[model samples]
Target: MHWHDEIETELQQMKRELKRSTNWNLDHSSDPNIEGLENVLKKLNHLTGLQGVKNEVNTLINFLKIQQLRQKKGLNVMSLTLHSVFCGSPGTGKTTVARMMGEIYRELGILSKGHLVETDRSGLVAGYLGQTAIKVDRLVESALDGVLFIDEAYALAPEGSGNDFGQEAIDTLLKRMEDYRDRLVVIVAGYSNEMSRFINTNPGLQSRFNKYFYFEDYQPEELVSIFEGICQQNDFKLLKESRKHLLAKFSELYIHRDDKFGNGRLVRNIFDQVIEKQANRLVKLPRVDRDKMMVILAEDIPD
Candidate 1:
């Protein structure tokens, strides 16, 4: 056979073997905590922004569901590598989604423990040569049967820093990833450009992380909705004019955003500042009514 034909034949054989290996009974009711998976999906649906992120997650969920269904039918199941690369800016909900994915995977019988262990360069890298490997290994151990979310993961590779121990941590993590492939999932998150560079830094990284999800920055309206949700959750109310003022402020923030522009985080900071200003405004009052105490006025918005 020609080279292309040979490759196709091999792939067909592999599929046949997978089908045979995963043959089993198709009773999903026996699975434990199935409702947990549904709840995770529901939460993903409820998230205000991240339409792209939501679609990607739902696709993965559907794939896993199919895999489980195949297993139930006593057919061979294909092993899935759940390791992923999350490319986005700060406050883009990468960490939040990672945590939820852990739970979803656990409920799907993909992980034994669905907890999330969040870390960064400081959590994995060390000052010395050998110590870096040890630190990374320990973190991988703790993250077993769960998800290990490494934020700002590109920082693990500092360009032109020959003596940097970050490379050592990456090496250790790669080994552990393979050793515990069935029980652990590692999610590396960073800015899109930086994360692309980081992935290209190691050939192994590209091969190991097959899934990439990009989180787009929240739009002005979504940011406003987020702020409103925060207010409702905290029992705070925005006056009619204050609501209009806040929307305009968010629109301005979105338009003039720089690399450091934090979408959700910026809204949160504004909310906090508004609360502080409201407190300062109310302190001078001889007596305050409940309505006044909970209401946020237009003047409370930061300039």
Candidate 2:
């Protein structure tokens, strides 16, 4: 056989081996569960903010559903690459959304396991030579049939660092991504600018991750709503004055936001502080009533 024919035969064999190992049966038809899909959609919609992200995810779900329909019809279907880049700042719900996406994809029969394995630079890269690849490979193995979420992925390639082993981890990751392209999805998330630079570091990275989700900072109203949700979840209620004060505080925080400003995280912190203060105040009460025990007063708001 010619060299081209030999290569083709090897490729076909590899494909068959991969199919058997993954137990992927393209002919097997599993009816789409509408209730499951709706539950996933409802979860996505219930998130505090990220209207744009919600819309993008809806579009992706629709596309995947169409692809499934095409496969049932025995029509030619193009491969769908679910790997993505999430660009946002701290506390922007990147990780939260990645987890949601994993469940959504799994429900759509795209991934066998919808679990998310979250890591960062320190998790993948090793201190010594030749170890980074091994470390990354282990992570990839664990993340198979699931999603590998690399937070602050830009740190993998530090700028102007000549001796960093991050490149080795990246190389290992890229290879495994190709080997398990059908069963695994990798999401790299970081600050918008830094993530862009990280992607530009490797030419192949851009092509592999065609979908980009940019999570915008939460607005003041959304932040307030998040705080309210937290309060309700924890069996706490904000007094009318406390609610007004919190709204103002959130607005002020949003207006004077810095690069490190935590969106949902900020609200959570404030909520915790208020709860602590409320407890402190309750301890001083001669006789704490049920309503007073659950109510957060304006004085509980931290300065």
Candidate 3:
């Protein structure tokens, strides 16, 4: 059994932990009703790097804490204006961070309920004009009191004056944002330049989204740490040579990440690929020996 497998094995040991429980305490006077949101932030805070981004999240989290206290005191919650523009090269962890934001807001009282409804152009809009509104409304309903994260928001701002359904989707989304100001946090994500254009395309959109955090490409040392961290997380022991090779591979990928995909997006595919290769190699090992199986050799990585 590998360490990565341990995650599943542990979950199996207690199905309830993997699944949220409906057993609310019978006492209505119980204290502190956070729904595992703070627990998630604790884990994220421990991850290395992203100091600047981490600080930004901490500030918002504090604001959320204030809102929670106000709700407990039966006071009106303050309106939120911390929508962000995540700019960076591929594989830098944008989506993962967004998910964490959802959990944080859930912990906070800014949202009546906090969750993330993820989608892109195809996911939000329809082929016809009027149809787009219905599609968008459903998305809004699903994201009620949470976040509706639209990735590649720039696609809505296509070149040359055309009535692509993209514009319809944007229009519907904008109207809903205003209508549902009491609930729902909308986040538009994509390349920095494209995201800027996306905002400028609509004045309403521009005025509302105020926070912007750029995710930089991982440095060589950062890549090494990321690679080693992945190995350790999955309970794979990389030989010193394999560790250097993995680092170099990821560093090369990060260097060329500028063509289109950013760091947060690109690095994950490499992780998945390595895991697949390692798993296949392990499968053929005459017997499943959890102990003797130690090192991942350099040959595990492609030339």
Candidate 4:
């Protein structure tokens, strides 16, 4: 099995160590508790710059609602495919949206647990023969009654490969998905083109994952707003000059962005650097106060 260099071996080890662990990417404790469907939708609407995603999710919710009404009236209801394909680049809110989808699904009476279990090729494929199946089986079992999110899912079917164990993991996962059709949901995510290729890798994948959601990269203003939100959450205040610098920097970044451009992730990294620079400036002062600690100057905003 070919492992992406970016996915550290420690991550693979964690998957084995925490085979029974729940909630891979999203933290339920920090998020607002889902008391009802309205609250769940409110949270979805709060996410930045995903108008298309928000609309599509609303469409699904309405469809499910009508399906429930039809069933109540004893009308024949069409079968629902809980599986989906999330196409996007890194840090474009694919994982966050997937978590919300799980909650929405639960509220609609589609899933039982609605928790999200995340994995990738490294989490499923093993070094030896016959081991991939076991790994996939354990992962699927843990994800029962919930959503199984496979990030960078295209890696499982590497181009021009033979005898790769990733295919075995894919086969096992497909079987488990069917066996738990009523109780489980699966979402495979990656770059748009690669995800399309992944779905076409197997007829089963194409059939089950007919639903697709495309997440566009955040615009310059959206990135700045995301940065501001992060600052508010962290108790940092950006001055007018700092905000101006940020807008220009984000605009430049957006203009020259490539397919692999990190949208929200780039903003987050800039935030980290800004905070570190602010701390360095404060350390040079004779004395510091709460105001100085909270303020982020123009110089703190990196070029």
Q: Compared with the true structure, what per-residue lDDT tens digits does model 4 show for residues 127-230? A: 99999999999999998878999999999999999879999998998888767666678999999999999899899898889999999999999999999999
Every model's TM-score: 0.88, 0.90, 0.75, 0.87
Pairs with backbone N, CA or C atoms under 3 Å apart (clashes), candidate 1: 18-76, 19-76, 22-75, 22-76, 23-74, 23-75, 23-76, 24-74, 25-72, 26-72
lDDT of 3 at 81: 70
lDDT of 2 at 108: 75
Worst-scoring 10-residue span by lDDT in model 2: 20-29
Each candidate: RMSD:
5.1, 3.5, 15.7, 12.8
Task: Give the Å shift of residue 202 in candidate 4.
Answer: 1.3
**Residue-by-residue lDDT tens digits, candidate 1, 39-71:** 888998888899998998989888777877766
Better of 3 and 4 by TM-score: 4
Provide backbone clash counts, one per model: 10, 0, 13, 0
Q: Of the candidates numbered 1 and 2, which has the greater TM-score value?
A: 2
Instruction: Rank the candidate models, highest TM-score first.
Output: 2, 1, 4, 3
Candidate no. 2 TM-score: 0.90
Model 2, 1-303: lDDT tens digits are 999999999999998775543333223325666788799889889998899999999988887777678778877555556889999888889999999888887777777778999999999999999999999999999998889999999999999987689999998899998787777889999999999999999987987887899999999989889999998998888888988898899999999998788998888899888988888999998999988988888999988
Predictions in order: lDDT = 0.85, 0.86, 0.70, 0.86
Superior by TM-score: candidate 1 or candidate 3: 1
